[model samples]
Structure formats: C-alpha cells, structure tokens
Target: MIETKQTMMNLPGPKAKAIVERDQRVLAPCAGRVYPLVIDHAQGCEVWDVDGNRFLDLAAGIAVLAAGHSHPRLVAAMQAQVTRFTHFAGTDFYSESMVQVAEALVASMPATHEWQIFLTNSGTEAVELCLKLARHATGRQNIIGFFGAFHGRSYGSLSVTASKPLQREGYFPLLPGTTHSFYPTCHRCPINLSYPDCQIACIDLIERVLFQTTTPARDVAAIIVEPIQGEGGYIVPPPGAMQRLRDICDRHGILLILDEVQSGIGRTGKMWAFEHEQIVPDIVASAKGLGGGMPIGAVLARAELTRPWRPGAHGSTYSGNGMACAAALATLDLVQESLMANAAQMGPRLMDGLHALQHRYPQIGFVRGRGLMIGVELIEPETGAPARALANAVMQAAFQRGLLILTCGVSSIRFCPPLIITAAEIDEALHLFEQSLQACL
Candidate 1:
C-alpha cells in the first residue's frame, strides 16, 4: 500500500523498461487505453506519469477513487487486513470487516423499514445480482430499462444498457425480455418537442409501452434505473419522474431498482443521488466509490425483499473479501472526514463553469447533473445532432494538458472528480476545461 515512485527517465534500459512495457510491448489492445506517459504511481489527487508529468485526476479513475489514491487510512486498513489474512480462509466464513461494513451500509440509507445488503466484487455484479433478485422475488420475467443508460458490460447488465451500439454490435442475442424505455432528458428530447409542450414524453413512453404494447407491466419483474444516469452523459431525468416510476412499480407489483453504482456515496453531494427526491426505492445497487477505490460492490434491499432468496440461493467467492471490507470501512470514515463537504462545495463551481461554457458555445447542448457527477451534451448547434467528435477531442486534449476527462452518452463530455477535490483545484480544472473546450471547438 506504500506510494510508488517509478518514473520514465529512470526507467531501466532495454534490460527492463517495466514502466512503459505494459502497453508498449505487451497486453491486449482491447483492454482499453491511456495516455502516452504511462503512470507509475499516484497519491491523493495527483498522478505522475512515467514522464514525471503530474496531472490533476479530475476523472478519478472513472469515479472509482472516493478518498483519493493511496489514502493513508485506506492503506493502513489494507495493511491490517493483509496481516490477518490476505485471502479469506473460506468464502463461507464471514469476515469481521464485512459484518461491520454491511451494518454501516444499510443504516446509512434512508428508510423507515429494515434492510439488508449483499456484497460483491464489482458494479456490474451488483447490478446483475439485483436483476436476479427481481425475477426471483416477484416470480416474474420481464425487466425494463431506460434509453441512454450504461449499466455494464456483462451479458445481463449490457442487455439493458442502451448507450452505444458498438457495445452490442458483435454480441448478438442478448438477454431476452429486457425492454428499453425513453427517458425525458428534457434538454435533448428524443421526441423533438420542448418540455412543457411535450410533458416529459420519455416517461410517458414507458407507460405507453406498458399499456399498449405486448410487454405486460404485471409480468415485469422490475423497473431498473440510475437515479442519475452515469455513463449515458450523467443525465438526470426530470424531477417527479422517479416518484412516478415508484408509483408505477407499486401499482404493477414490480420491484423498483435504483442503480447507484456510480452516483452513490456522496458523488451526488447526497448519500445517494436518488436522495434528492427523498424517495426510497425497493432495492439499490452500489459500487465504485463504496470501496474507496478498493474493489467492492453491494446490493441493498428492504429486509422483506430478501426473504425469497433463502440460504445458498446466491453468493460469490469474494462476496466480502477482508481487504475490500477494510478498505470500504476506511473509505466510509474518510469520506465523512472531508470528501463529502468538498463535493458539496465544489460540485456547484464545476457546474457553473460548464453552464457558462454552454452559453458561450451553443455546441454545448445541455448541462445537467447532481453534485460532482456532471455531463455536457455536445451537439451540432444548429441541428442539435450529437457531437461525439468534439467530446472525444476534448477528452484527448484535456489529457494532453495535464488534466484527465471522459466522454459518454450520444455525444457528451462527462466529469466525476474525486470527492476530495478542492476549490482551488476546481478553478484550475475548469480553466483546463475551457482550454479543452476550445480545442474541441
């Protein structure tokens, strides 16, 4: 857990150029990509590439590092857990850290009734697990997802993910009975009509599909959604939409599942992004920030909802890995220490800059989100067509200028900085963003 200090120049010669060797000579191209200067180590909110170029990590490893890289508390927790046991004696035997984390997780959420949690290894796993829970609990088959959503890459989760066609291009015959409904993005309406004029047609579309189409609402096991769609341009569906879905789920005996995988744990300046509406979903899935960059995922459900899944109904080898639990526990404490407050203060500053950018450049279609989770829709100003080229170019330029960013949705530049980011950091990052936007333009 010690901070690493390997750099480019000092890299061993031909004998062993370990720092740059990962991508230069070895590894699969499809494993994803990074900048030319390979990173050797990082601390707090900074990452030093092999070339010794330090960059502010606005993307935070795609919103994974909640407490910042190699946090002291998290490192200590990992060290302590490693000493006790690097790997658990057996997956069945419960770890002390796991129990404590489970308790803390369930209690942290807002709900008048009892709840329970099941830990896993990744966000996709939690999401897939929730889907299974829906079917198992309701004894039904159908599952409804929304448009412009990015669930995960797994077979089940990806089946419902509708962000990019390439994600499903080669993989044919995805999970069946999974339907996609349009969500009222409000800013870039799919129906081409303005807000009040159209009255949130996206949500209405879901209702229409249920009533007029063959997909019977009663047969639907669950209605799954991200309180604020993360990968699909960090889109936050208009207010009252979520509450309406909750009511729909109740009326049809369908489970309401909220995937907070990326928007949970204060990323939205709230315990959970759905908290903005003060509504409690039947089940919630979370990961990413939950473990403070350590690998961990979980699904929380009302205590009664977990009843159908009896003993041995479901589980995983690393359901509650000791080290992951320790890291998650330490993360919870660290987030409370100061990261949450930072997110609350800095979220608005970043948003203000982004909104201003939209005003300056009509190409910046719409800006929307909660807390640090923000997204800027890139569009052809006149026609409102998605401008993926601009978004991608912006990300590339941002990386070149010692800042990192990501793109999503049809054509949206997204931002999800570590919760520990400071006001000064926000100002500097925004300055870089302005430069990146210029490059994109």
Candidate 2:
C-alpha cells in the first residue's frame, strides 16, 4: 500500500513564503514559477517543501527523474564516480565512463542500423548538435519543422521550435533556411482535415506545397520532428504518419531528425518513442530523462552521417562529465531492467482513470498519451473552445491539494510521473487530480 499525504495548512507556510520572496528579488522574471512552493527535498515519487508539506510529484522534474529522486542505485553510482574522479573533460581527456555510457545508449537504439553517440550537457545542446550534423552531412541549408514543436531555446534549435510565439518573441532573426509545416494530428487537425479520409494531407503538403513554393526539396537538409508533440500538447500523430514521412524523406534524400528530448527514455513505455512507429531516423536528440536528473544529453546518428564532422568540429567543456556518465549508466540499467516495463503496465491504468474522469466531467475534452506521458485537454464544453484559464486554475488547485502537475499546449494538463510509480500511486494521484478538478469547476 502506498501512503499519501495531502497538505492541510495554507500553502507556502512561513519558510516557503520567505524563500519565494527572496527568489522574486534575485531570480530572473523570465523563470516562470508554477506555484509558490519551494522544494526542500524529494525521494521516490514524493517531494516536501521547506515547510514540511509533502506533495505527490507527477511532473518528475519535468520528466527528468525516471529512476525517481535519489534512487539508491543511482546515488551510489554517482557517489562512487565522484570519489574516484569528478571531471576529466571527456572532450580532450580519456574517460572510461564516457565510453561505457556511449555504448549503453547505442545498444538501446533499434537494431536496424549501426549508430554512434555524441553526449552533451542538456537537451538543447543535443538538438544543436543534430542541427549541425544534419546541415554538414548533407551540405544543404534548409530544414523543415512542424507547427507545434519545442526543440530547444538555443539559436539553432529555437529556429525549429514553434510551440508558442512567446518563446520566439523578440528572438529573431532566427536561423535562416528554417521553415514550418503542420504536424499530423487526429485530435486537433491543423488543416481542418480528418484522418484516413484526409490521408495525412499534412505530409502531402510538405511535398506538394512547402517543397514546391517557399523551400525547394533539393536545398532541404533535414526534417526535424517530435515523435509525439510535447509542449504543443501531448498530441500523438495518426497511424502511418511517421512511415509516410520516412518515405518522403527517403525519396527526397533528406535526413529525418527525431527530437525525442521529452518523449524518449521509457516515458512512452519504449526506450525511444520512435520505436512505436518502427521508423529509423538519421539523427536523434535525447535529454530529459537520459541522466536521471543529472545534466546530460546525447545525439545518436549513423556513422556515415557524423563522420564528415572531424575532431574539434564541436565540443563542450562539460560534454561528458564523469559523474553525469555514471548517473546515466545507472539510469539505463534501471530503465532496461524494470522502469520501462512498469511504465507499460501502469500507463493503461492511469489512462483508464483519466478517461473515467472525462466521462464525469465534460471539461476534460480529451485525454491522450502513451505510458506516463499523458495529456488531458480542457475545453469549455458548450462552445468546444480551449479553456486556457480553467486549465491554469486546475493546475494551481492540484498543487494546493498536494499534487504537482503542469500545463502544456493551449489548455491541457500533462501527467508525467516517474516510471517507477506503482498502480497504487497512480490511483492516489488520480483521486487527488479529480478532487482538484472538482474544486476548480
């Protein structure tokens, strides 16, 4: 049985309030705070604020802690590595940990092709690496991205990110030779087309329209896409959409880059979300859960694709820190052994409960996801328009009820708990979320 704790006192109790007050003065205003609660410590699937209020963590540090906070195995590995040596700058120096991690990551790839790995310090950097390799390998300039995607905040990745206009506000001129197309969606079709009948007109638009008009296919280096739209609501593409994209890329001789930064690493009950489609990408960017909370990212590509870039082409001072690699190795071991299976088993249970909630409350217009990466879209019901304000209210209410959830897309709440979460914990979280929804309604 799982023990659950819901805060009884007013939130931000003294100590948390003081810290938030200090933070407001010191931190950048751009750093958005979902709630006023200040984290004191976290373990497994629960976190406690400075005021000793315990809350169930459904966000998992924005889907980073796949092994859960401070797992004994991960802590031991990181501790052991730290004692031996902390930093040796794998860019110039030799480190066994880096090689081991690279091997482990490559082993997780689909068995269809021979692959290699380049490690980075964050998801954004991994994306930047993919952008550089794609452009270099093809010697082409133009790259295509979907309408609703969040690659990263870096200049190169930002060019492909179109999740929200706020992220791009005043940030131009973005990288040249970048264009956008609508991602295939069944829930909210961008082009007002239905599935099967529409026959993924979005993909056809890429070839027939985008290629013919603004950007020529000959100059296109790659098409960067997220297997499942992350920040643009957890929108999953219709069946065969990926395979169709692969065929188009093949025909055009354009590289396909899968940015699995948020949807990868067992979050979707698979090592990589792209496995669901059984398609092989020319380059893949991964981060969020790769290091199990430690800062690490990686770009995996075929040997021929990356071979063109010689040494000293791109390197970071903290590309492959010894401790981060140790953490990553431990994370991979746990994911392969049990966490991925756990996600597969618990995902259906969580979704069923959410679906039930949808029946009870029509405000939950839609619920869709794979594994722990679920999204519940809120709508006004009468007009069938996005209830963005209501979504924010529900998220805040959930926090007040000792449940930590985040909002995404236009008016959707994302439930991305750690993969280690059990059935009992899922039930508890569902109960709390239901209560919060009721209160907000």
Candidate 3:
C-alpha cells in the first residue's frame, strides 16, 4: 500500500524561488495566482513542490483533473497518440479518436435526444459556441444570464459573467444584447426571501420585470446558467429552480443553455449536473475535466437547434485534436468504470465532516455542495459578516500544514479534490482545514 507523506519543506525553496522570480518577469499580469508553491510532480490526489515537499491536493487544478494527475491510463493513451499523430485540423479533417470521443459523449447524455456536438479547445470556447448558436438558431439577439454566475472570459461569455467586477473592469462595450438576473441562492437569498415562501422570485423577476420593462422575451435568444455556480461560489440553487427556467424558456422560445464547465463530467457524481434536476437543457457547454489533464471543450445541442449552424459557420484549428481526444477517451472510461461511483459514495462523507467542523467553528457560516464539488463559507465569528480575510488566511495556513485548497465566491473555501480522492485523504484534509481555521482565529 502507498502511504502519503503529509509534510512539505519550506515553500518556495531555492529552486521554486528562482522559477517564481522568472515567471513574474515573463508571464502576463492578468493571471490570478493563489500561492507561491511550485509543483514539480503529482500523482492521484497528492502533489510535490520542487523541494521534495509533499502535500494533499484538494483544488485538483481548479477541478480539472477528475481522474487525478498523471494517471497511467491517461498518460499511456496520450503518449501513444502523440507517437502516431498530433494535430490534423479536426475542423476540416477527420480523426478516429475525435469521432470516438464525440460518440462517447453523446452516449453519456441524460436521455435519447438527437444530439450533435461541436468541439472547442476550452470552456470559454464552448460557451462562445453555444452563445453564437443560440443567436443563429433563434434569430434573436438578446441573452440572459445570472448575476452571480461565471460562464467564461471570452467576449460573449464575459458579457454574461457577473461574478466579479474585476473580470470586466477594463473591458468595455461588451456584447450589446446581454442582461443579468438574480440566481436562486438559498443560503444568502438574493431577493431577501425564504425558499418555500419565496416561490422562486428570482426566476419570476426575469419574466415579470426584465421582460416587461427592459429586455423582451421575444428578443431573448437564450438563458445561460450554471447547474452549480463555480467561481461565484459553489452555490447550488434550490430545487425546481431549473424546471422553472425550462418552463419559462418553453413559453418564450428561448434556448436553455447550461454551462457545466465545472459542475459536469462526474464532478457531481453524475454524468451531468443537470440530470440531478431532471431537466433537459437545449445546449450543454462542457470542459475542464473533459480531457482529464489535457485541454478540451465541447458544445452538445439538440439536432434541431444545431441544424441552423451550417458547415463553416464555426471552426477552430485545434478543435478536438488527436491528443486531446485520446486523453478524453481514457478519462471517460475511468469516470464510467468506478471513479464516479466512488465520488457518489464519498461526497456525503466529506460534507458530513465539514458540517462537524462548522458546528465546532461558528466562523464557518455554511457548508453545501453535491458530490465532490463542495464549499465552506467563512464569516466573522461575532457579527457573522463575510470574512474574506479570514478565508484567505485559512487557505494559506492549510498550505503550511501540507494541505492544498482554494477560496471561491466572496468568502468561502471550496474543496474540489480529484474525484479519485481516498476516504483517508478526505479525513486528513478536514483535519488540516480545521487546524487552519483554528490558527486563523
């Protein structure tokens, strides 16, 4: 049995310091970096920095590696494909691996809907594809998105992204016909109303106010949403929220687009997060974990909606490259085999542990998530105000204690470990997290 070494040498050791200095000088200033630890290698749910320091990784590269880092199966598949062929401009040409991946993804859908796929290179591209298709198919210009939701950084997606003002501060004159509405965040209700009595006022506001006064439903092309909001916090809406959106779309002829970049691909212990709500979206944007560690994204839509997008309507050079397809095929196989089931079994266990910590520490204002995608919100112990500083301190302290975690939303620590994380690893992470919280206090 392989036992993990839960300790690290002083962070930014000699080797890491050299690299960090060089990176700061050369890399773009737009990249948001959390910590200074430089990774040298990783396996399963653990990572080591350049100084031979080992730490338990719970971030999973921002929830990208569902199969974990350096999995033999994925590495072997990618290596084999590299030797055979690398890129062939999949948009214009064809490759067996690319076709096979599309077929597998179609089969992984929730139900039998005549679906077609358009491959891209990242989640943002997937969102861009869906945005363009919605406008093209519906022949409408307006789009609606949630206030605390993040789709991507591209022009069309960024226009709908309202998670942080910083992401859109400098960029001006975004896509013209985009508007934002409140999401059903039950923990901190956006409309200042309770769930059972509120009757989903957020969804109602779209039709009652926004449609009637500003953006008419007739001109709206689509409503893009995240099944579980990612960067805005791992916030899951109350039940029936999605159904209500689907009903609204049905009445308005608006395409319901689900941006599952962070919540899909077995991260929620299911093939797709929307399946939990039992709602079939008109289009689903996927990425992050789709290619294990490799970069890949795709847009899945019903045949009717996609039919309008004729050939050459949209194309990219690296759309479904051979290497990415190979890695994705191996990732899908592993996710289907046993990793997904393991995530299903382990999710509640992790949440329960987090709940216990919350009980012990009142500073932990809330705990919520589905499957491996979890969040613990931090607040001031006395006033219950959002403690953004406290959250950052806990994250840094956790790193010192050989734990790798991250912060999301305004003041929440998001725990998105690799889906292959073991039970023991989960327990260790919780223990380290609690210790960090105590240190911060």
Winner on TM-score between 2 and 3 is 2
Model 3 stretches astray by more than 4 angstroms? 1-9
What lDDT is reached at residue 402 by model 2?
92
RMSD to the hidden true structure, all candidates: 4.2, 1.2, 1.6
lDDT of 3 at 153: 95
Using lDDT as the measure, what is the rank order of every candidate, best first? 2, 3, 1
Best of the candidates, TM-score: 2
Model 1 segments beyond 4 Å from truth? 1-26, 89-91
Q: What local lDDT score does residue 315 receive in model 3, on the 0 to 100 scale?
A: 99
Model 2 Cα lDDT, one tens digit per residue, 1-441: 435554434687899999999998988989788898799999999999998988889999998999989999999998899899988888999898899989998998878888989999999999999999999999999999999899999999999999999999999999999999989978778789899999999889999999889999999999999999999999988889999999999999999999999999899999999999979999999998999999999999998887778899989999789989999999999999999999999999999999999999999999999998999999999988999999999899889989999999999999999999988889999988988888888
Clashing pairs in 1: 8-50
Candidate 1 lDDT:
0.82
Q: Tens-digit lDDT track for model 1 on 118-137?
A: 99889999999999998998
How accurate locally, in lDDT, is each candidate?
0.82, 0.92, 0.91
Supply candidate 2's per-residue lDDT for 358: 95
The C-alpha local distance difference test score for the whole of candidate 3 amounts to 0.91
